[model samples]
Target: MHPSQSQSCTAFDGHRLIASGPLREVAAATKQAIDAGAKGPVLVFDDQTSLPVEIDFRGGVDDVLSRLGLASAAADAAPRGPGRPRLGVVAREVTLLPRHWEWLAAQAGGASATLRRLVEDARRGEQDRALRAGEALDRFMQAMAGDLPHYE
Candidate 1:
């Protein structure tokens, strides 16, 4: 059986009992604080209890503010301007088997130039497909308009 089931407890929100057990147990300690009406979403674990005791802070506004410090300080600390772009840049070492290397080399025209060419080809293909789709839609719309009755 769960230890919480053996104790009487209630949640701060009054929705349900958070937990129950020896005061030393963290879950029990948390439940006790909630039952006692501590506000907030956090339960701080304390060392005093034999089992970890969680102290529920009914919404630790002061703690939150203290932790947050000055917002302007954070903003000042932030690295300004656009950071380095990671895309299209090789960041790590990759190992390839001879067969795999050969395959890539075959596609890439010898391994080194493969990725660049593939990316360029993909971009061109995408642009071409988009242009074709737009033209087809335009023609379809024109045909549909011809079939519709025009108001005099």
Candidate 2:
């Protein structure tokens, strides 16, 4: 999936946070730092997922931005397929038990709509999201800060 302007990222020089903002901005900052011969082991990460971001910074800043923009362009240029392209609905297989299928069939909307509603309802709780973010952050910390004193 292509990231939007709201998709923020952070760049770190070892354990220190050097840049934090939109992907393009952070990438520019990172490229500049690396070009200026900053210390080794600089990395970038997605703030939402707490996952390391892999960016190819081989070219100039404009080229870097162009590469990042291409993803957005490609996603937007994708040919519309079946199943409500305007609504951004993608069709994927769902293997359910016969009873579950029967229940979905009995719902007011079709199986897809009903399943979407059920999933939305289930995801309505902030607790689930908070827990997931915490877990992701924990994983990132364990990978990046495990060697630090009393990281736990």
Q: What TM-score would candidate 2 get against the native? A: 0.61
Candidate 2 residue lDDT tens string, 1-152? 35555579889878777799878678888889989887857878788887778777888877776777633322344355667656565677465689999998998987989988988888788678999899889967876798899987
Q: Which 10-residue window in model 2 sums to the lowest lDDT?
A: 70-79
Using lDDT as the measure, which candidate wins?
2
Off by over 4 Å in 1: 1-100, 106-112, 150-152
Q: Estimate each model's TM-score.
A: 0.27, 0.61
The best candidate in terms of TM-score:
2
Q: What lDDT would candidate 2 get against the real structure?
A: 0.77
